[model samples]
Target: MTSSSSDRPLLGRRSLLGLGLGLGLGASFALAACGDPGQAGTGGSAAGGTLKWGWALPTSWDPVFSSAGWDVHSLSLVYAGLTKLDEQGTAVPALASAWKFSTDGTSVTFTLRPGLTFSDGSPLDAAAVKKSLDRGRTEAKSLVAPQLTSVREVSAPDAQTVLLELSRPDYQIPNLLAGKTGMIVNPKAFESDAAGLATRPAGAGPFTLTSYTQNAKAVLRRNPAYWDASAIKLENFEVHPLPDAATVVAGLQSGQFDVAQIPGSQVAAAKAAGLEVQVIPSLVVAVLDVNVEKAPFDNPKVVEALKFAIDREALLKTQLFGYGEVNHQPFPKGYVGYDPASADLYRYDPAKARALLTEAGHPDGVDLTLTTTAAQGLPEQLQAQLKEVGIRATIDVVPAAQATQIVYIQHAKALFTDQFAGRDSAAQAFQVLFGEQGLMNPGRRTPPELAAAVEQVSRTPLDSPEYPKVLRAATALAVRTMPNTFLYSVPRLLARRKSVSPVPAFTAVQRFEGVTAS
Candidate 1:
């Protein structure tokens, strides 16, 4: 939920290819034939200079109040949570050195690392943690409210100990704390109405915001008093917020920026131009939101048919330049609950798809509209794939804002091509995309079997021995019901000058924790 509207451009800009989408196929094919990706570029040592990052500006610097991806991305450079999520979505220590959940699962106790303080010279103690968490839980405008809905109370039992009591048994608390919900704030710097924290943000991160120019850029200087001062390699960290993909590419091309989030379609071009293209396997997935509550897709056989109609491997190769891996389940491989067996459920077989379609009473195939944002040649690629299985897919392209309104708000009954990135856990993703309250399940039409599986996955303790089984079962049920056809996980590509040694990031949000550029 921390992602903003401008964060939706996984595909390259329509203008970058110097042609409209009608010419997308030619451009993509021509670009795909340019060179071998593996041999495109290589790595080098950091040059030890000021690291300049060209990216979209954050919507707000206040972590609790901001849901924009760019906002969280920028705030991360200036904030630290109690826990941090690893590349595999595992919870590791940050502010909190240790934590333990009660046997009954109603309360979790945490022990803070000794002698932590915010950059504002205020103590980052248990009381500060409680105050920040309480505000996040109680604030009506907080974007993380849904993630903290199970919390009953937050208490600071002692100077270094914090107790979190929940209304129900919830195991994802640690993971939640590793994200925006657990990003602590300085009580002295923030006001009751949540005013003035953006320009003058305060945190215990390795860097301190020296200046912030709205819609333009933010400059961060090393926090001399930071607990992990040794990790601060760069003397100055500068971020330029530029939303347009073309503009970002131009910046990278013109040597104006040392790093930028380059689109997948531009990876080859960036590499050819001598930029090091680093691939970050994003948590974001491209999915066809099949309207299982309506006709055509309502039938399970029809859903199965639709799933088998597309070639995921080819799609990844042509659409993403083979930058990402193919995934059949909604959860990618690194995330918890992702089953390798699920990949076998839907293979690219037109004969099988047509057979299933015939069994579902559509002998001549079904006519459906696949609506999506202007995602380069994705719609056309999907349309051609679906046509091979005797299905007629009409493409409807809309702007990103209007597309969100149509799919999430209007509950449009079309095969909506959507890109989703969410909390690290598979259960959290299910809750957002397929649960009874999920965005795609507007009618709450989750099958009884899947509903029970989702419940089990939600209630099961993550560390319990039964966790993997329960998660796998939930994933299997989800695939069977087929509310959404899983496509490949999109690769978040970035271009950096060879002089920079970018720290490898598993997810899209780039962390410069140990990175440096000369």
Candidate 2:
């Protein structure tokens, strides 16, 4: 049964809110309350400035080679997607003025914004966009490749227009193009220096890479040639990946960082220090990936046992500090894809987990390793919870930069846990999380029933009144059948000085469009 539209924050394609996430979801708490998000952020200085941001750097500057999903946040600095998500996650025009689908929905056309140019002074026209998108879909190592499987061809109809031919009817294209999947790069730069993009980037974004140090810091200068350069207030922006909570607090207190991301535990500390804290809903979701090919998980009963073994509520309240809600599926509440049926599907029943383990031939217990990165913040708590059900889980902490390569690519462990930065479209999010050959699915096979349900969602248009209903059903199926299980939906917790405006945010990506002092 379909829930009331009120449960969803739907702003259709015609409006600013994309795929139903809302600007007014009662989100973004600041200093206990945010008077009006529309009002300029109060504490920051109200003039041209430089923002010293404490954020995790993405794996690579080149979107095609970037491995982590949250890398979209970092890539957005030097690269602008063809379209951007509004406060509600809707596909709003950025590089493109407008876009539309054909009568059959198998093809779409985008009208490029006039006079757009790359940061290096190259024309960012239809041909450049087609080239970049083609590279994303065709490049073997492109992490965004799974998101574009339905896209058969990319063509430039004219200097002002680009066309996409789909292998099937797909209305999710525009929203999918809103982030990393749609970010267009300068063709000349890549054609001449593809490898260099791992460190240096060239695009039509608000900023340009001035300097970069792997896993340390990156300095960027405002792009004078950006399409809406006049709207950009900061002259310089520097990003430091300080994943440590203590470091974030120290940086904020020392005035070394005007803006820094902190764990939910630091919310009170930030407020006590007179810093404005913006804790807003994000597309980020924490997920546990089980390698079905591995011994313990190879048995269906063992995988099912894990579903009941995890204590999601405890983790959310204790480890997460009650900042985010427990989630059974990848899509969070208030999203069009949220599935009510998935609620309480596997609610912390250790007895049931043990029974399933016994049925799976592990009469005594099961031994396994759970690999996680420090940035995930889900430490010993997860390990301790699993022990209750006779699942002896050894925890291995991997480096943030090497986690994906180690587990997803190397298959170094039987299980992995990390927070996935969500994609712009529900279809793309589903694909990356559940589809065959998905980065998260190292086992490389999606259960057929769940696959069919997801396929229907991909074909349905978000503007269709039935879109949410279809997506919800698919979400439920994913949780019920897939080895991957979601724990909770997390927000991007940030503390910023009164001198700088609250950093503009939606999902994992934060923008400095109007971050000048007030």
Candidate 3:
């Protein structure tokens, strides 16, 4: 893999970096020309043109059922939530102009921006907000349902006000609402058959879906009556589904696309071709997950040995091409509650790994299978690394569905997977990957100290001084337990033409929301 120097600064700390990014978005937005891309007439020099966007296509057009990041991007162009996250994962206002939590922090009230109307010419009122959230929670196939763990009830008191009552004091609710689950769909669509709506959906975003071809392309035209017409510079927006990273990069260079997502390995290649690339150091981490309920993994010494065996620095430099940050704890460094010291628990040492394995009764060797979703050359690298430490790891390439089944359902001994926080909060990350109630915790067994620490962090106010201390304790416990071998937080890269400027905000899919095509 070729490595390149990025114009964007490398993220030294996760939380501080995130806050800085969010503040940048909140400061101001640039103006773009307004008009159709295909037309000649224009009012503003920076506005009135079409933006042709190309990225990995979404599997489903329905926001509730869509799981892939690309799908969220496509859906976000048409649908919007009450709150939207900035680049730092901070919640900024979107549909709802502002909100306030009760003194007890159990309920929140939202006030919608006035004069709002859906693309279909219906009022975007409090009732619509209630309906959208209820449907998202009730839908059987919705992958977003889990994010609403704290939502107990959603009620509309009047046309413009909506209230959400939570079961506990979850400060992360606003952040969660800024995510995919909070996307509001047309209530009329919900009244009809749910499956049919997947084919045709409606929302009140800056763009209207004029036409869609599943997993192929989606054509969008500007919503003439959009509440924020000034920001809707692009008269037309087109989304093409191109999943292959190399293919997407080639398309950008060939002028087939104005913007596209490319892997870190291709960042240098894209930059060398004179394309403008923006790198966002996000909370996405790739690691080898171990099922503690399984045989050898049930032993703590065996787990520690595996962590010390792999050369994480080499893996990041080679596999990720230096577009990532090495981390050994469940939460990436710099994130709120992450301990910098936890990363030093296990250093790369083949001899120490072999000694630990021998002490754990694997004198000869240990055989295990590492399941993954066909990551390029990663499985082979993992296998070779394990071999050096008296562990034989066979790679099994499978689709995501199959891999999920093997790791989550079938209780496979170990698997290589990537984990990310939907929200910026470390408490949420803990609940998903290490919490007893976490989906990844197949057996629901958790170390008591880790569980207590997570609980403390979740309940403590974000402004409280004790919050950081609680998170540090949680990070320490998580690293000591070695639930999984931490790897690196992969950097997200985007390559766009110099004429196109990316919006600073973050949508669910990180699409071209506020982008301007000059």
Q: Which has the greatest lDDT?
A: 2
Q: Give the 10-residue window scoring lowest on summed lDDT in candidate 2.
A: 13-22
Off by over 4 Å in 3: 1-46, 224-229, 330-333, 410-413, 419-425, 502-513
lDDT of 1 by residue, 337-424 (tens): 6776786678798999999999999999998888777745888899998999989988887776455456655667567776666554
For model 2, the superposed segments whose C-alpha errors exceed 4 Å read 1-47, 374-379, 397-402
Pick out the ten consecutive residues of candidate 1 with the lowest summed lDDT. 11-20
Look at candidate 2 and tell me the lDDT of residue 255.
Answer: 80
lDDT string for model 2 (1-518, tens) is 11111122332111001111112222221111111212222213233668888876766778887655556777888888777777667777788887878878899888887777787767789999999999999887676676788899999989999999999988778778877788898999789989767767778787878777665678787777666666678877888876577667767878888888898889998889989999888777788888898988989999999989999999999877999998877767777777888877888899999999999999898999888766344758888888998999888877754666677677667888766666777777776677786667777779888888878977776677888888889888888778887888888788998998767766535677777753
- On lDDT, the stronger of 1 and 3 is 1
Instruction: Name the regions of candidate 1 deviating beyond 4 angstroms.
Output: 1-48, 68-71, 189-202, 213-215, 241-250, 294-296, 440-443, 458-461
Query: Model 3's lDDT to the true fold?
Result: 0.67
Per-candidate TM equals 0.82, 0.87, 0.85
Cα lDDT listed for each candidate? 0.69, 0.75, 0.67
